[model samples]
Target: MEPPRRKASFLASMKAVFWSFFGVRKRRDYEDDAVNLNPVQVIVAALLGVAILIGVLLFLVKMAVSQ
Candidate 1:
């Protein structure tokens, strides 16, 4: 029988993936360099940005269809 797997901590998992992808250690150097936003805030902003982008695209599409 296989043993139960150990759950990984959020920070540890994130750090491991960060280093593997970027080839460097994570730091707080950018923490105060600018306005810092949380994941939810970023996601919401991205969704809003995409919505605006899609609206513009659909407008262009409709214009082309009408022409």
Candidate 2:
């Protein structure tokens, strides 16, 4: 009979490769203290914050324009 497939190992290997990019990250155990934000998360949050600010500004402008 043919050998069983090894799809599980392929997924494990991909996870290892993906996490290797952030080598030796410091672990944060304290729940009451500052938490480290991942780079991508920080970038995304900044973008969303900027978008919200812009939306508020535009709303204010429209109100002023209509008055």
Point out where model 2 deviates above 4 Å. 1-35
Give the residue spans of candidate 1 off by over 4 A.
1-35
Compute the lDDT for candidate 2. Answer: 0.47
TM per candidate comes to: 0.46, 0.47
Worst lDDT run of 10 residues, candidate 2, spans 29-38
Q: Which candidate is the best by TM-score?
A: 2
Local accuracy by lDDT, each model: 0.51, 0.47
- Deviation of model 1 at 10, angstroms: 25
Best by lDDT: 1
Q: Tens digit of lDDT per residue, candidate 1, span 1-67?
A: 9754434344444444444345564366333212333444444555665686689999999999999
